[model samples]
Target chain A: MTTRTTPCAGSEAAETEVILDLDDISLSFGGVQALESISFDIRRHEIRAIIGPNGAGKSSMLNVINGFYHPQKGTITYEGVVVKAMKPYHAATRGIARTFQNIALFKGMSTLDNIMTGRVNHMHAGLLAQALYIGKNRREEIRNREFVETIIDFLEIQAIRNTPVGRLPYGLQKRVELGRALAAEPKLLLLDEPMAGMNLEEKQDMSRFMLDINEQYGTTIALIEHDMAVVMELSSRIVVLDYGRKLADGKPDEIRHNKDVIEAYLGVAN
Target chain B: MFYREAGDFKTTYKADQAIFPIALDRWFVVTVVLVFLVVVPLLASNYMLESILTPVLILSIAAIGLNILTGYAGQLSLGTGGFMATGAYMAYKISTAFPGLNIVFVLIAAGLCAALVGIAFGVPSLRIKGFYLAVTTLAAQFFLLWLFTRVPWFVNNSISGVPTAPPRKVFGFLVSSADSDPIDRYLFVFIITVVLALVAKNLARSRIGRMWMAIRDMDIAAEIIGIRPLTSKLTAFAISSFYCGIAGALWSFAYINTVEPTAFDINRSFEILFMVIIGGLGSILGSFLGAAFIFLFPILLNVMPGWFGLEISVTLVTQVELMVFGGMMIFFLIVEPHGLARLWSIGKEKLRLWPFPH
Candidate 1:
């Protein structure tokens, strides 16, 4: 039962509806088992964190969620629908969006343009309109621009909106990357090490932004973070991954005390 | 006073969505197009029109086609000449075999034929990227040229391996052919180039265009966003090849009056690439600038000899041209990597913000 595990903030009645279901998910590249028969359910609107040392398959889990790498075996059920292997764009259109551990914003484009690209799905003005810059196409463009402007403002990137992301500070680039994901209005937001390289101030700002996004937009968040403190502070439920296997899945407090989780953290494999 | 978007009011999405959202920018383009189409014909001599304008117009079209694949789509191609040749040869075959077919219809068909080939070659892009991908496109260039030269039917078994364009007329007036005036030829090419350029611009701003840029920017992210890489890439190839085909057809029918397989040689491919490179990579206007720069610079270089009445050797001119071209490429890459388009945009921005760069 999820009662003893998968810590959540909402009422018991609403928490049981699954957002993501991993059934005996097994994946490998050549001889290495990147993930092995991992099974779990991510309930709707929960801030879930998958944590482990380097090479614990945290990123692999994120990749598998969006069908970047088809697993060697197992089925992934998202929103009560089973997905054998769906394209990334299909996952995106289905309201799933993710950020990379390494920043992946369009390097040559200004931050505003980079995020605006996320709204391409919503803009339907055909090539003629875009080229001719006539009538309905122009209107759609402005509307998209205004929407992106609001997102830029919301992300507090107004000062650097016109600056190419390649020139931005590392923290700002990460925020812009987050802004890009937010532009898609995803129902499930995946963050890979959102606070990997930030100092205290950046960590605080990003943490606040993550919490605000969850509270205001009611977006579901799943993240992988190496910083135990960040995991402890932000995650309601912590899924511990060790050598591609699930060592523990429980409330943050329970995970802190579990011996198997302790052994994994202490670098003593069991 | 300088680069401001102040008073660019927008009541509807369309008002704000224009490619040139600022009224001033739109007016500038209209004014330039007017000068190029209406005014130039009235003032320019036949010699300038034929020798200068004709080639520039044709190169502009070729540059735009390759820009779609290389610039906007983020795929580098070295096989533009091959696709263009496909168009030329196809046009030749269609014109000769299907005698009495309007040349206009023949031209469109030729471009479509080239587009099919472009899509075939573009498929390899799904697997490779950057320099490696560029080399693969060469296979398309060489293979296509070989097919045309060795295949007797392509040239209608002509001994020259070059097909001669029959003097074609429109309503009893020769628009462009061996006997047509360069002025008449320039006008026809200019008109068609403008229309196709508009289409290219439209395409770059559409969903397909955005998909290409997304693929260029980040393939992993683009795939995740529900865009099929194959579709985007192939579309870019299709569009690019169509333009190249049109340009190729124009080269034979209007400008050259004859084209051998070597006409669409590897040098032709590099020339088109240089046009894109010197022109801003993703900027449509860059194509014109690049074409003008590549085409006009040689003439300007040759000017020194002409003014002094010095009969400079073609070898000397060719050598000097290479040096200047190489230097220009390196200078542009180091100074402004975005190409000529960025330079013009920066100039416009400066003009917009002039005297008030606060």
Candidate 2:
């Protein structure tokens, strides 16, 4: 129901300048390699989807981008600056916000509080002012609350604004997680399986919100999704990973027709 | 009927974010404060003022301190007594060194000393958590108590290793020492407790409070959300110790009127922890409730047997009090893990939905 032009109309524009570039990245845990020689680039203001089967390093790629995990090898470049290492909070302060593959909302906190936490970077009230809660702290809190309320309205989660995220249904939890990330007003939003456990109707609603977020805010999104149909419809470009290696990188139509991608990821018996 | 809020509406965010949202709750608090200021001293006996009321008010401040660290920030600490001792000694030194300084400033300076010590011990919390972090705080408690005992500088090399607190005046009114009325000391501690509690309540509802809660609820998620665990956790330590330090200063200067290394021992730390656990971890009111219950229970236990004309031995009464205290701790842990604060909230929740029963 969100008023927006088709998502693809702007995907073909020549103004697509690269915002993130990962070159020859590798990661391993103990002796097992999680990713090897993976390379990809995400352009500005586009919905980029990463797809793979289970344990194919899709989540790890998202982790590396946000500085949750350090790759043993490879360099990550964002907006022409090379990041030698990533600390999670550092990346968040730099306007890169992300949702986890699992719903990682603070279960003990209410939805409003959870979303309010996303404004931590922007809030600068010191300890003494906060302890008094008289002027700056109070004003900052109200202002952030207003901003978070907009996110709650955007995601259509007004009814459950006070509910503890732990009690919400899986689909609603995912939506709240998205709201939390969007509260950061990020330049690049990373979503790990945003619709992983959603029903068809829930998936449709989530897809619409994602499109609205991208259209209204002009936010650059990179999401990992397993649903081929949802990926094909929502993403401007798709990158396929199989067994810790990149199998294909192209538009959804090209990735759909690529034999190696279909065989490695979709398990097509060709 | 009186608790109903059907017609009440907040016209602004400032009103909505008030410490007490309900009009009735606000009125109730106003009434309590008025009564404490105007009526309490007139009716309370010297024994009640000295033994029960002063200790409750002071320890409640300490419990609030622990709640900020262990409750709000989810950092378990057992160093409350150590920090309290730091405050007591620092206050003693500051008062003796500069006789002209106000006792209030002395207490504040002592609290700062305790905060620095708390931060020093809290550094280990960054690398460890849960039971291990607790052990580190326990180490701080033992180490501080040992330091006060072994080092004569803290006690000013007194021959007895115990010093009677010298008389102190605040605003030209005698508030501490044998000559001061119990009511004077009670009022003095009462005002300080009230002020510090208000500050704690404000802090618990502010952005800093939310950040601590985020770290407590989930540290990894909190980090990704742009909260620095190092800073938030350490601040929780610092603030918690600051409160405990003030409580410690009051313990020696206003309540006990004496300074001794054994005054703040490991037992004191455990006692404060019990108050936090039994009161409610995260609730400011819970800290006061827990302190009152812990402080008054033994006296109640002692008086109950006598009231029934049973003529029970003092030893038997003490044993029964221990049994009852342990039993209540376990019961609270099992039945209401959130402590008495959760129960209070549940009662309020019922009042909010009284006419339309769920």
On DockQ, the candidate that comes out on top is 2
DockQ of each: 0.47, 0.78
Q: Native contact fraction of candidate 2?
A: 0.72
Worst 10 residues of 1 chain B by lDDT: B12-21
lDDT of 2 by residue, B308-332 (tens): 7899888888899999978978887
Q: What DockQ class does candidate 1 belong to? A: acceptable
Q: What is the lDDT of every predicted structure here?
A: 0.85, 0.89
**Best prediction by TM-score:** 2
Candidate 2 — which residues are off by over 4 angstroms?
A: A7-10, A13-15, A268-270, B355-358
Estimate, for each residue in B148-255, the C-alpha lDDT of model 1 and write its tens digit. Answer: 988998988898787688777656657656789766787788888989887788777655677788788888887776678888899899989999999998898898
For candidate 2, the chain B TM-score comes to: 0.97
- Give candidate 1's whole-model lDDT: 0.85
